[model samples]
Target chain A: MSTPVLDVQGLAFAYPDGHQALYGVNLHVHRGERVALLGPNGAGKTTLVLHLNGILDAGAGSVAVSGLPVTKDNLREIRRRVGIVFQDPDDQLFMPTVRDDVAFGPANLGIRGGELEKRVMEALDKVGMADYADRPPHHLSFGQRRRVAVATVLVMEPEILVLDEPSSNLDPASRRELAEILTGLDVTLLMVTHDLPYAFELCPRSVVLSDGVVVADGPTYDVLTDDALMAAHRLELPFGFDPRAIGRR
Target chain B: MGQGHGHKLHFHGHSPVHRAAPHHKLLALLGFTLVVVATPKDWFAAYGLYLLLLAAVVVVSTVPPTYLLKRLVVEVPFVVFALLMPFIATGPRVEVLGVSLSEHGLLAGWALLAKGTLGVLASLTLAATTEPRDLLLGLERLRLPQQLVQIMGFMIRYVDVVGDEMRRMRIARESRGFTARNPKHWPVVARSAGALFIRSYERGERVHLAMVSRGYTGSLRQGSDR
Candidate 1:
């Protein structure tokens, strides 16, 4: 296979208060693959994604994005290649208008003038928010703000898209819309989520992290259907969620 | 696209003032305010001219007079202060409506009222014509400190988020039968305020991380390329 779009080896991290979040975790994603990172609360999933783009420096292992190691020297390039859609849209869409928010990443990369506007427009179009370009993010609904947040990253043209809890606080319609948008994108995806149904719908593969370790990694359907594995990692499917009934269409 | 959350001052219109560049409007308003402030208190004619100028802007911008007047309520405290000056100042006395008042105090109060009202009116006109984002961009173009501009940007962006959080907390407190009807309930309010502060701080950290992940180096790019 071609070089992995993202590769993590022996990654370990702990908070300043000495609470270890990740312990020598290892993961890899190839081009155009959508992988879900599933875990119970405080299970180090967020810590792992933070390390993906050098937001959190690993205590032991190494993380490389698109063949660039996430070090101090390569952060600018790594960030350009690994776009992360944070859990909270409010945290991401800090610009005055949706257009400015979408332009932010490219502007930081020294992209200016009409080219920047074009990039902003293209990203907004991708998320179906092109008409809302001039609207302030706060004026948008939760789902609309979330779409603009994705556009904010898409303008960077990152090789890998990492999303944290993309479905939280979304209405059912918005949730499905987001899933559709994610599936339509042509980039490697690493989604960290507690929404098991979302994982089943969007991701083909799943990796379960519990207590800072990869407890299970396999096809999503297999992982979700494994009652013993789901029970062991404290990942409970919603009541009456039959994995076999939901075909991978 | 829709009514912006918590932004009530800006009146949507397609008038010349609304279409004018934000920096131009901002500078014009600043210059107009300075002129109004510098006008002699006894130059009542000049104050009238200033009022006419603002009125023309109001008409041209198509911002409703009633809407503009309502927003002027923000100047109520200053008006109160100005009103108190006429009663408190010690000066030569004058009789008006069977009440004796200081002549100097009357002039001082007039100056305060006229200048303050003009300034607020001018600002309201600018706000009604321009978007808040454009206003911040105008400040940046005016060469204000970059850090100050960014601080203002973040404040505008998250003020609603924090406000929503506060509202949710209030709902939670209310659901638990907590109400600040007296000093005895102050502790609960104080504790919630403290929690709000901590939550805001944590959100700030998370926002900073999100920025870093998206290649935020230091200064924000002023994207008025259009």
Candidate 2:
């Protein structure tokens, strides 16, 4: 695999109120590898994701996206290389119009003129939202709005796309569409999700977190099949539904 | 989830007024109001002509006359104020229907009505023709502060979401044995409002974090898919 695009070492973070979220988490993502971070609530999945993109400052240790360290000075460059999608589509899709929301990141990055406009269209097209450019965010369905949120980040064309619960609230069709879209993208992905089937489908590697620590990381099939570890972390497969059999072609 | 996206109640149609640029519409509307406001008490002819101009615009735009009049009823609460104006002032008596009333007061009431109607029509036409996004853009072009525009843009985008959330909260409270009949339940209503505010604040923080991950700096911009 290409040299690790994202490098992290012993990352830790605590809210000012003293609630520790991430506990010395050590993880890395290589180019073109789709990795899933699976854990129950309060597992610090979002906190770790925020650190990857430098959204929140780490209390300890280090994080680097595409070799750029997450810091005040390198934040802009790090952000450009790592696009993170929040769990809630409502939170992400905040512009008056879909076109505006998608163009927001690119425009902020200083892209302008015909080139900027082209990027905006291409980004919307990436998420199958070309026809929704004129529609306001509030006017779209939940599934459609979720796709627009993805487009908003895709416009940046980051090297590593980090998603917090991409499939969380989506319906079956939307979930399938999300899987299809994520699978087709040729970039590094570190998605934080609790859906075992979704993780098995999109990612070949699975990383388990519990109490803010990475307890297990390995091939998706092997890690998911470990029932003892899954039980400890509250991860489970639905009745009679198997991940390995359904995940692969 | 309004599948029937009752697409905001704007008076939209293919009329000269509707087709005009939002910038021009805003200017014309504001100027018309300013003229009415600045007019002398006896300047009813100018005010009448301006009202006529507004009516002509309304006809040019295909917005339902009833809808236009209905929206104009926001001034209903001011009826008492208007009624008292003529009698409160000391001026030449203008008694027609066997009642003493100030002529100045009558002129003032007419001027207020004419100006208010004209202003509302101008805004209605602008809103009917141009979407909110376009209106914000027009404002930006007019050199309104960027911060103000950004705030307004987000407000417009999320108002419906927040409104829906509020509605759901009310429903939830009602389902749990709360009702408007109890005077003692006022605190519960206030608490819900406070809770809603907290939820909104947290939601804003999460949303901001999401934006930063997607490469947002402080600047806000929209795509040109159109």
Q: Each prediction's TM-score against the native?
A: 0.93, 0.92
The lDDT of each candidate is 0.89, 0.80
What global local distance difference test value does model 1 have?
0.89
lDDT of 2: 0.80
RMSD of each: 2.3, 2.6
Query: In DockQ, how does model 2 score against the reference complex?
Result: 0.58
| Chain A TM-score, each candidate | 0.98, 0.96
Tell me the tens digit of each residue's lDDT in model 1 across A188-229. Answer: 899999999899989999999999999898899999989999
- Give the distance in Å from residue B204's predicted Cα in candidate 2 to where it truly belongs: 2.5
Clashes of each: 0, 3
DockQ of the candidate models in sequence: 0.59, 0.58
